[model samples]
Target: RTNDAVKTKDAFRNQAARLGFGTPNLLEATEYPLTRLTQNWQLLNSLYRSHWIIRRIIDVVPGDMLKNWIKITSQMPPDALKRFDSQVR
Candidate 1:
């Protein structure tokens, strides 16, 4: 799971770099996706802490197009995508 998180973060950061958004801060960026992609869903399913995840998404993700990033990562499952959609909107 941690490996999944790292891969997701790397892919996201690389895309951001390609789009001239700059890479995510290594120290700060890892934890958010790291925790989210672990398949635990405990934090993702929460009400209050979900804010943190959303904020992280805003901070780390580049540009307005989010679905691109989701697709690029190829790490999020359908259920996770649904949760992300609801949380994002």
Candidate 2:
């Protein structure tokens, strides 16, 4: 499921590029070593704090549900959506 999500995102990015829309490269934004370290540390800390609970959730939760939850929580703003729609069309 995670793989599917990644593939979908990549496909979207590729399509956007083909349509002349520029997508921000998150990796480039975090190119500084200190920034990367901070991000990694935060991820590690979060995992350390909820390792067991996260494991249980992953073991029990359906991938589709998790994907939907992520999408709902990470919705684009109206203006962004409008821009995306215009560019996509």
Candidate 3:
């Protein structure tokens, strides 16, 4: 059964941890593929939420100020954009 399989997997993980085979953090356990998938999913969900929040904040900005800000940013050099992107990330 699925439940038995999960229990067996957990038991193996616990035993491995007891023997110091891996980190105690379940999310960092690469032996389980689901952990990576879960981390990626969480990252994507966080990005989606951040994008939505930024859009809402942009909507609240005054039209003229927003336009001026966009124009200034558009005039920025590629290096400047890269630095800004890194800082944002």
Candidate 4:
């Protein structure tokens, strides 16, 4: 929870074991952990961008999505925001 690396490692290992990789520990399951994190990041980033574009088009998106987007904006660290904004502009 809350960006805890140990939890991240454990979840990564467990998921990999389910997929039959049988990695015995975090070090062994390195790729599995990265794959899982990357997959989730892709999903969240895509949904965020897609809904953002759609909302601009129609001037509306669900209230919940808008709220979550606003919260996510603050959740992003300053360096991350600057890097992202640089790409945008």
TM-scores of the candidates in the order shown: 0.19, 0.18, 0.19, 0.19
Q: Taking the tens digit of each residue's C-alpha lDDT, what string does model 3 give over 3-43?
A: 55433444334564554346366555557434454468677
Task: Please list the C-alpha lDDT of all candidates, in the order they appear.
Answer: 0.57, 0.58, 0.60, 0.58
40: Cα error in model 2, Å = 52
Candidate 2's residue-wise lDDT over 29-76, tens digit each? 665544454468677678757799865665576765655442233478
The model with the greatest lDDT is 3
**Candidate 3 global CA lDDT score:** 0.60
lDDT, candidate 1, 7-87, per-residue tens: 343433356444324644555455543444547567555633658767677556556665464433457897988887778
Q: How close is candidate 1 to the true structure, as a TM-score?
A: 0.19
Greater lDDT among 3 and 4 belongs to 3
Q: How many steric overlaps are in each model, in order?
A: 0, 0, 0, 0
